[model samples]
Target: MTTPANRWRDTPDRYGLISRLLHWLTAAQVILLFGVLLAWKGFGEHPVTLLLARIGPHGSLGAMLLVTTLLRAIWAYRQRHHRPPRPPGVGGLLARSVHLAFYTLLILIPALAILRQYGRGGHLIFYGMELLPEAEREIAWMMAPADLLHSPLAWLLLALIAGHVAMALAHRLWLKDGILARMLGSPQATRDT
Candidate 1:
């Protein structure tokens, strides 16, 4: 029942409880982050302003997300993932590459988003509490280009997330590969039978 991910038992791909907890927590946070993005864009017109006003400026939120993303990315590369063996062929390699890309985009986009705001002379408020800006307001003049980069890059990350979800569904419904289970469900999910 073990996947290639876990094959190297000596390597510790079987995450400790704390690491697993962090992994799942960050995963949920990332999903919520996307929801926040959706609301921000969708509500850009009228009544949504009320909600966003309450949610507060994105500079702080994006900065917080960027920090969390960096921490998670560091934790991930620092450990191993206990994955199962492939059925064969290029599909396995493709799956692994996609997984890596997900991690990459999550880290990159959040950081870039913050940089975009920073360029606008705004500082991260950290959940509405006033915080000093990392750089001079004068530097926001340079952030304009970052805004241009942040928008299109955001969409690209969205596409990557969609593909990630699609692969999970495909593994669960069609391939019967247990790809989704490896992270969400314990290996014992199959063995319990």
Candidate 2:
């Protein structure tokens, strides 16, 4: 019953409009964050990097990402019983595992970073909104997890994303399945008959 115009809700064969938007929006944010991090690491604080950092720092963006991931998780859970069936056998299991990891890291990485931010005894102002008030002193316990895991976990997330993309492309181009089209192509074009 899902037509092109009514693609706002998910069908068994394809993701709905809202889900697609959220997925792409999250992807864009992740790419932007990666770019900023790479620039900061490579250039070591040039004026341009500083300006970019001030304009779109990791903490604020991470907060945004955290919110997006939470909303996406809720949406996915609500639609869980309505979506297309996973492929059977090992492919299905692998797909499920990758999705689980992605969701876990998406929520945890920024959460840990945010904890670390507040633990450093500094106020966090995200796009002019005050998220955390300044602390009196650095809290070692609060900061430790992020200091140890945030960057490494983020890199792992990036690797998973790479694999995800590769698998999507393989599904579309090599396997000749419509997996990528379910998310990216016209819903009508990929609709189950």
Candidate 3:
């Protein structure tokens, strides 16, 4: 198999180098994790317990998302480096904030969930090994705040993702703007298209 070139294009340039990679990669992980979580929760399984069982083996993958999210956040702070289209205004600012929140919650949700499990004498499976802690916990009371954070914030993330997709579509249809295309390498009419 051949490797793809470092992809770029002028006009509302494709989310820049780092942003594009982080955007898609985080998207995939979020969707997978979203499915795992919704399946577990919608079925009335204790979300934490269910995740501890299912997502336990995917610890490293989750960690990767965390790292990627951080890197993406940093890149987002300096997006002008790629010199893309004109940035968004107040509306865009709000939308961007929502997206950032979504990313943050994704990282915190799994991490705290796992740590909650560990603190509560639960098993974490990574690479098919029962990745349990060797050190014992003296206090058994765990999963309290993690459980509190799980449901409500999860619902919030659901809304954010929905709105994000809707905004992208709005940009495509209503705004007739370059928002979506720029992210996907559509040919633009101008350098800052």
Question: Can you give the TM-score per candidate against the true fold?
Answer: 0.72, 0.91, 0.70
Residues 1-193, candidate 2: write the lDDT tens digits: 6576758767777788888988998998899889889889999879978887877788888999999999999999988886766789999999999998999999999999889988999888788889889999999999999999999999999999999999987887788767777787345345322
lDDT of each: 0.61, 0.86, 0.65
- Could you tell me how far off, in angstroms, the CA of residue 27 lies in candidate 3 after the best superposition? 1.5
Decide which is better by TM-score, 1 or 3.
Answer: 1
TM-score of 3: 0.70
Top-down TM-score ranking: 2, 1, 3
Q: List the residue pairs that clash in candidate 3.
A: 12-193
Best by TM-score: 2
Q: Give residue 159's lDDT in candidate 2 (0 to 100).
A: 97
- Candidate 3 achieves a global lDDT of 0.65
Query: What tens-digit string does per-residue lDDT give for candidate 1 at 65-137?
Result: 6666676666655654433444467987886787677677666666666666566666656775766565665
lDDT of model 3 at position 127:
57
The TM-score measured for candidate 2 stands at: 0.91
Candidate 1 residue-pair clash tally: 12
Model 2 sits at a Cα RMSD from the real structure of: 2.4
